[model samples]
Target: MKMFLCFFVLFILGFDDSSSQGNVNKAIKILTKQVKKLQESNKANFEATNMKIETLKNESQTNVKSLDEKITNQYETKVLKLENLIEQTNLTKMDVNSLFGEITNQTEFLLKAMDYKLGILKVGNAECSQYNILNEADRGISSGDGDNCDSTGLNTSPMWKGASWYRFLPPAGTILSQAAPGEDHCGTWLSGWCNATLPTVPGSTLDIEICFDYSGFQCWIAYDGKVTNCGTYFVYYLDNIRDCTVNLRYCGAN
Candidate 1:
């Protein structure tokens, strides 16, 4: 009878152990399923984060390109504006030059002749360089030594520091006559004498031009703005005649 009781108790204990083990195994399977679900959720969130980062990177690159395009367009617009301004400035300069050239032509066309002797040109203490003298050798001209230009006016002297004197004529531009400081000159008793011709045509005008060199003492003459004659260099002696002035003669003598 004891052996039978012992076997029943042992069977009861074994079945209890087996049922506990089964419950433990079910609990473990449930916990494992929950862990796998959480892992999958984490993986999905990571992928989403990566996708957001990629989108932001692409957006940043596009923004940069757009900004660069805007800047380039602005720069090009400014450059075009500057070019237009430069063109306008050049046009203005050309117009000013044209106006100045016209005024110069009018002034030269209406130039008047001046006689340096008989106090005719000596209105004040002004120098001879102010007036362009017109003289003819056939007509009488008084002459003497230094500063003695004529007997009429003792102070009416010109810049005659050089040895040779030149007198130009109009129509066919030529040195009609030349003189030196002596009594034996072509014109008698003349500090400077020249046989000059007067323009016969009524509308013809005497035109003279001076082309100055960079050196202070040298200049050249041009007839009617044309350099046709050679050896017309005007050299200053004692640094006296350094200025470039037009000296033209049309009606020279009586």
Candidate 2:
């Protein structure tokens, strides 16, 4: 009976130890699986974060490229517009210069025509052989019948007509002397003789001096025999002979 009881006690202690070992093994297996699941979750989170960072970088690069292109296109458009403006300005300057050249040539020709008419007036007055002098001894002198007069008598004084004298005088003022060409004051040409064929140019004045504030100011001749101011120049037409009024058109801004 004592041997049986000892054997039964030993069997009970062995069974308890085996049961504890089995429980420990089962707990270890469950803990290992939980750890594996946690590791997989962490790895998935890291991959998602990396993908988000790569997407942000790509968006930033695309935005930078778009901005650069817009800026380049605006700069190019501005440069092209500036170039076109410069070309147009240059063309306008050339056209103004060409028109001014034609005007100068016409003014010179008109001045020459006036000089030729003056010489004829002086010679015709000198050849008159009969004259009537008041308050002189030889009062009534005749070229054909004269005693002690060597076939030639003093010439009669020539009378100037109103129309002929008006040509020589400045726009205002009386004629102080006989009408003559190439005779002017202040370097202007005067009309001494009137010819119907050579009518004065309409809207043009003679014997007027045109001065400028700058050196490159140009003057041109119109279809009429008058000088016209050209370019970006200030023109002053002075008439010292009289208080003459002038109506002028503005060529450029004052």
Candidate 3:
């Protein structure tokens, strides 16, 4: 603005006369210097503004990435916590059942151990109709006599001539029909257990089905109309004759 006013003053003076010609020339030089300075100042300001804009843009991008990562981590954490909670709930249910078994029938539990199959029996006294594998060795009560049971030891039959405690352990699978008398046979309760979490309602006995297919080693353990455990551990194992049984039973709930 000052340059414009000075140029106007110089024009007015020059129009007055050639007598002030020297002063007019000096004014022109000063105007030229001011214009050059103004151009340099504008160039510097433009560069500075562009740098600020670029910096702001970079900061915005970084903030967006950070926020996205934070949100993703939070989501994963929540999912893991929910999974852990569900697992704990299932474990607690089993714990409660075992606790009741301990309090109500210690001997029965000792005989049954971790057996899954039940003898759908007409019992004298029991909370549910289905009962774990209890036989002449334990109580002389079973679903089928010797065909599905190993009652030879207790004087029921000549016996298949094998062993006991096979169905009383973790896998409660029965391979008696498929296997021989003594070698890990599928006796009656259906053997081949797969890696499956047993779905259960809290504070109740788990009436879940666990089946293991040794062919391809696929296992399905389910309860409450949902499949729980399905993996390598429970489904397929033949290396140690301990877990190489065909645990096939009713496909799904009837």
How do the predictions measure up, each by TM-score? 0.33, 0.34, 0.34
> Over the stretch 61-166, how does candidate 3's per-residue lDDT look in tens digits?
9999999999999999999999999999999999999998777776554334333334332222222322222212311112221223223322222222233212
How many times do residue backbones clash in model 2?
Answer: 1
lDDT of 1: 0.38
lDDT of 2 by residue, 1-254 (tens): 44754665465455654477676566557656666777888899999999999999999999999999999999999999989998998998898788777777677545443443443222122112122211212211111111111112222112211111111111212211112222122112222111112223322224332221112222321111222121111112212221112211111110
Estimate the lDDT of model 2: 0.34
**Which stretches of candidate 1 lie above 4 Å from their native place?**
1-19, 96-254
Better of 1 and 2 by TM-score: 2
Candidate 3 yields a Cα-based lDDT of 0.39
Sequence-dependent TM-score of model 3: 0.34
Clashes by residue pair, model 2? 103-221
- Evaluate residue 228 in candidate 1 and report its C-alpha lDDT on the 0 to 100 scale: 15
Candidates 1 and 2 compared: the better one by lDDT is 1
Alpha-carbon local distance difference test for all models: 0.38, 0.34, 0.39
**Reference-based lDDT, residue 75, model 1:** 97
